[model samples]
Target: MKKVKHTVKLLGALVSSVVILSACGNAEGIYDDKGQVFRKVITQDMSSLDTAKVTDNVSFDKFNQVYEGLYTAGKSDKVEPGVATGEPEVTNGGKTWTIHLRKNAKWSNGDPVTAHDFEFAWKRVLDPNTAAEYAYIMYDLKNAEAVNMGKKDVNTLGVKALDDYTLRFELTKPIPYYKEMLAFGTFLPQNEKIVKKYGERYGTSEDKSVYNGPFKVKDWAVEDKIILVKNNEYWDKQAVKLDKVNYKVLKDSQAGASLYDTESVDDTTITSEQVEKYKDDVALKKRIMPATFYLKLNQGQVPELKNQHMRLALAQAINKEDYVNSVLNNGSAVTDGFTAKGTADAPNGKDFTSQIKSPLKYDVKKAKENYEKAKKELGKDKFTMTLNTDDTPSSKISAEFIKSQIETTLPGITIKIKQFPFKQRIAREQSENYEISLSGWAPDYPDPMTFLKIMTTGNTSNNTGWGNKKYDELLKKANGELLQNAEARNQTLIEAEELLLNEAPVAPIYQKGEAHLTNPQVKGLHYHNMGGDTSLKYTYIDKSIDRKTGKKKTK
Candidate 1:
């Protein structure tokens, strides 16, 4: 790893060449001598800026910059105040949550942001017409499910705007993890006027949405390039030093590496081959992200997958270690539980995986036996199934590897592979149209419940149609009684996870690992443990000072 020379003129010229600079001037104060331009490449274009409808990591990352939630997770994975003044006041055993907003907060449009904005956002998200994939996240709110199901009127929902600066939320249960859930983008505020004006076009393009966070999106052409400019009207604009952030969508890893090599892009992720070429580069950094890649078994569509023995056998047959090492080559580790490895501690200060039985042992003999039983039960000569995946290179490779392993392990089973565009694949998976779909989960908050409770009987994310009364009971206890008592809560969550593992509803594959190639000239950039986009609110590129200090240290 070698340090490179930093030059403001050269970097500024490079960034300006890629994006149109609407209003340009010299950086002020500490950044007067340092340039304000930075560049990076995104793997996919953001599908929508509507926080409620976003489901994928790309959309989550982009929307995070444009919206500000009541609370946000800091680098330490602890809940921190964002739009709120401080910790919310909880009364009536968590049924009532009162939040006080910061007076200085304002939308990018110069409209004073109020607590009513959040009320509008939450109601819209839970509305049945919205069809938000993450709508289940708000089920804890009183009457939310009923409202979403059209059983109750929207006005009956529990959130109310108390004047312009205060908001109160009423929940159906005593949810201890409620505060953390507020940090999710789904809890961010939205402007009712803007949404109505754009109608269906809202959040589909850069001009269709409003921003209240530290940055504003610009020039967002799908599959092309997107840009983020510092929001001058942001409440914390003083801390946002980077004037502009540029993101180019490069689907090809080799092309991304070339862009980094040619200095066309300031930062990019490397593939396995590129790792060997640039592992020694000073800019290379790796992180273990809080995400789990898994194979979703569509029990509603595939009768064979409905057999617990067959699902367990399929889980044992696929080799996760091989996929992590051969395919990812990025530092991803094998996942045995739904919760990510490095996520926050459970109530008992114990690892979440320790509480669950490991479902990831390799057993070819058992797989064959289960397949035989499945064939007999189905009254068919052969057991055949199709695995659906996205068109990404990594997904294709993973799908092929799984296909080969299943074909080799199960003598009479024939596996077909189908790959579609990322968006189309999401639609298919949502419709329960595939026998097995490759999908992943990145936690919206730090709680273990965030992972385990999302697949209950009628959860919106329960695409598998998996329902167990006992499992649901455990989840209910964990969410209600256990949350109030920390020790009890941890034990209950562990028990619930074990139940899910035994049922084999979803096959755990590998936790994700992220690698980025940052420019030596870029400073103050950090990756969030949760799989949201990079936060550039406090990030800046200083060329006049040492890269390590970003300023002249005084004796």
Candidate 2:
């Protein structure tokens, strides 16, 4: 493992006791030296940079800068070329894909990036010993399931390195959206040598990983600041204007906002309260993210949650509008269905809400009646449930609001809120140890199937244990027969989603919106719809220009 040292500046700490600091003033801005672009992002702690095991947005955002996948999402949320030079060619009726890589790409260590790196990375992720949370994301690849379950040797996996720059993939079926899946982080390559050198420490911290993308990690201390510097070995280095990127870890929104206000940081997201104060600022910008915040009922932990009436009552008891407008004051919009609006390529090119029955609107009368029916069905004198959430300020507020609403709307129903740190909350969620869990989903790709297919019976992400055999059948059909026919595939997906909503396995809440402030001098910063790090490959600070040479330089 290569350890890179960096200088850091201490930002103010919050009451939560998390280390908040900035990583600027190192090597004097890359833009100042070489006319490169740079961005300063504010985030909570970055748990890890291992793409396969990463779940938090903060970690993913930073990791994205340090890695690249075969495909990537473009400005229009459509599939675009990344490491690969062009779109993959389907040779055997979509079951087999041939990918031609760009010869010029290289890793940060100057090693030629090749197809073999992908093959090695995919096999490592699916190995049962890896225990990656997103392993199921690749189960569509031929033999991936068998390999993951230890029924097949890793050598039998579908991906193959035909040569130094040519790769092939065999899919279990003809999936039209398969190209979109390749854009996900799990598909990013890993340096086998680096992994072997670090062994157990591989990807546990910043020192253990190597860069193969737009940036490289530097000066990363857990719960503190992590810095990213541009990869000069990148194939498109000439196009990448960013020299150095800095991230400040601050859990409190107020403290983060203060950093942005004082010009100590380049950009930071704002809460609802801060939105009102900063909306008029010239730097404020709004982005509609493809995320759905919802509640997960743990039927395994609480039997009452298994009862259909209790689930329906609980769904109706909370007011989504109030939650979005009051609790999440930052521009979030209440969603009538699980999928957010504006998501492209939906069934019939229509929003998911358009195809579903009217959602369980907020009605105390309906909630109370259902609560009574639940008590009667359970044959209990009283019913009690606990809601689990992360200890973040936004999560705490959201949990408390739901608790108050449920207690006030439904009589004889007692609810408790349990707050845990982010790590503990993730552990409990994975173990199914909570009666109810507050969770959110940010799309890994552009397609609706990414969000819709996770509820299947055997999916690793289906920790809620919510499964419908018919829904699974529809998804399989979509992945196999209907995928090549886009229209047919979308219709099948619509049916699957309708079934999911009718079952009410997960209560849909609202589509999230982000409020953030950026320095006006920061030019060419692009926002990614998928919740990864913002890309600055084409960005640069527009300092004064050289009049004779038509060149720009930092002022």
Candidate 3:
């Protein structure tokens, strides 16, 4: 279901003991002699690298480096051509696009990349038998919906390979961000031979998959480390200076920081508890992303959550500003709406957040009044439920803060706090085992649709079991008939968000911010708020030495 980046769930109550790992700095080359090797840490093991199956950021980050799509995101979020030679030839009123492939593009195995690869990859994702979680991303293509629903043959899909180096796609309507969307990993191509050979074991480990980008997976030790080396056969190998890159998996936040401090790792993300410690450090960098950390209220499990007033009461009871400033003192911002700022703006240059009419606000008196009304409507003065969340230190603190705020604002409500491992939490959510769960979402694209489309009827990611026919109709038009009119499309998304707000399927908490400590010697690191934040194609280590002084260049 394209799990949210940085979101996890713990299995049970928090354990007071914190284990420190014994230093293996010597056994593992903390820093290679070449000075061209870079190291980083990941909290969780990667899920997959196959274009059609990979859903989470941990896997997508590596995929972004090892796979090339039609376009690739570079510095400042620029969409640069990858497999495509140049910008597409748009015709037929922006519905038809013809792309010329780059002649020099080659896979790691030295095979030439062709237009047929794209056709096969796209059709495979849309095929109902594949059951891909991200197949909905292609619904804008002609007949893609019918094909995915098993009502039409996969061959009827919009994409086709005109020749060995030419590809064409017929879209249902003009997409304003078509080029940007193509840069996403979901649009990447796959070799048919490799897929058939690996079968179910594809992308399970390093040796199972093939590479076509700047880097290739050299080794993957599950739950330990993933090692990547430069793809010497890549089209642009000269630009990739890094000889090798290592990603170590360490679940403990403190251990990650220690690795960075001891020169064992080049960079690592910092938890909220360590934010203050690094606030004054020069290497500390804070990135405010277009993501929202919120709670998914499962109305299917507890019918009381279905009441609009009950949901509204829960949403209004919390002080979002406090949650961001106090609970998440890591540079996050309070958000009253689901979509975060910096993702999109209106045609007139106004931000999307400024145009929306807020449906909920913070007011203790109003919250109490709504709570009373909900109690009366439900015919129960006392209500009890569980609030599930991850066992991370920050998540535990945030859940406790939310519980306190809601309990103080509403009367006769008993809440049980349950923590689970991140993976188990996702399993329970899919099973509908919890009434409410702390959840978050990161946008797949810059368009508002990335944030609004999830709650549509029957969307696999909509774990809340919420649906509205009117909302779905608005979204369908926004992606179709309203495509040509920017203002109208913007208005439709606003209206759709208003409906979501009124229904109150999720409580908006705060937009997230990333805090990381990077070694100064590591240079050219680029990031964007949306999709695959890290891009290492142009990134290189500044390992130059002064010829006369014999001193290394300072970062």
Candidate 4:
């Protein structure tokens, strides 16, 4: 890979303001009680900010604010050009893309961001040694899979820099969603010089990285708080109104709600208990995210999980509607399919979920019959299993609910709930260390492939230890050979999803709908379902509005 000219510049002291800049005009910080510029609570501390390596959403919350990709997600999660001046010039029957990068884009260090940076970043992720979990996302690139699998060298990847400001990409097939994929974190560019300078330390701390996005990390106190100040060098900094955004880590929702009530934070997520308490509050809000929560049964730990009857029995025993409406009074809804509803609309404007027949439902009789069959096959009168979940208040409550439901429905099962911190829980699940683990997935992109492809054979996110050769073949055809045929690809993905639900490797629980509170003084805080975590660029604290009434305060 060719290296671009690297320049390092000193970052002088950032101008301090006790109050926000004139952009907020006469308005004061809504959470100004703490002398904060802007404030919000993160449910979990960030895991990593390295775009190429980080996999969790909290880490993405930081990464998405500090990095800009060739394309950026716009309002409503549409793909918009960022570093790239416009949509790529396509040729070779959609197999080749020529992107003209904006020459004005510069790194936080005043180094010019160029096409070579993208080439370097893409190849770095594709390098097997990087161990990036999202490496499979780039498999559409010619030789990407081969390179990541060690069958070919990283240099053989189909991306190249035509010059300082132009990039070319060669694809294995015509991906209609290719532009949207570019907006994802894995495709974001990195300054080769900074990466090489920091090596292992890159992105580990606030100052260890270079930023090209709307905001840069000012300070990060691990597990306590992260401070982000506006990046003046960003290409679109003119639109960034907030001088700073502070993310404080708070895992307890009740504590967060109390803070929100006292105006200590600008935003906080609420638990089911608080949902009814704040139901009449004018600031209470709800949003349905393009995310799904599920149970990952570790077939590797318990071979009985591999039995269709056993898996179905467990899935059928849970009353999903009651779980959503009663247990989780949040905006969540019961989902019968793995892919959440409203995620994708078919060609005729019908929802994708509407086209499929769900194999999952709450039927105690069916569950008992299946359980009997499973017991007969395994020759076991009773068994004890562990249910693993995160330590958050909501996770604990939900885990307890699930345990009660399952044990009551299935006569011979004893469930013990084991709780770990969010990050630790993810690690345990990734290692396939538990019998049944509660898991959730927020799609990296809008396409169904983001949700569907995770279950493919050997995919990193498939912690269930489930695989079907036919399922893999169908997905391969949907994403590759049938890439250009929308009708064919849709049907193929539908078939694959049906097979997955029928096998019940992982049981779909609910699509996430967050019922939370936001300070009315904070404006322009948008929830983008298909994009990276919300950026504070356009968000501002408008103190002129009455906090309780959400109306303009009159003198």
| CA lDDT of each prediction against the hidden true structure | 0.77, 0.74, 0.81, 0.82
* Residue pairs in collision within model 4: none
lDDT of 4 by residue, 1-555 (tens): 001001000100011121123213423433443322567877788877678877777777676788899998776787889899997999999999999999889999999999999999999999999888889999999999999999999999999999999999999988887898898888999999999999988888888989999898888888777888889899888898888887767666666676666666778888776799899998799888878889899899988898889999999889898899877888898887898876787767798888888777788998899999999999996988899998766677788788888899998899899988887888888778889999888877767788899999889899888999999999988887787778888899899999999999988888988887888888877566765567566778788889888899999
- C-alpha TM-scores of all predictions: 0.89, 0.89, 0.91, 0.93
- Residues 223-244, model 1: lDDT tens digits: 7778888888899898888888
Candidate 3 residue-wise lDDT, 156-206, digit = tens: 999999998999999988888988899888899988788889988877888
**After aligning candidate 1 to the native by TM-score, how far in Å is the CA of 356 from where it should be?**
1.4
Provide backbone clash counts, one per model. 1, 3, 10, 0
Which is superior by TM-score, 2 or 3? 3
Candidate 4 has a TM-score of 0.93
> Weakest 10 consecutive residues, lDDT, candidate 4?
1-10
Instruction: Return the TM-score for candidate 2, rounded to 2 decimals.
Output: 0.89
Residue 225 of model 2, lDDT score: 68
Whichever of 2 and 4 has more lDDT, that candidate is 4
In angstroms, give how far residue 515 of model 1 lies from its true place. 2.3
RMSD of each: 6.5, 6.4, 4.7, 9.1
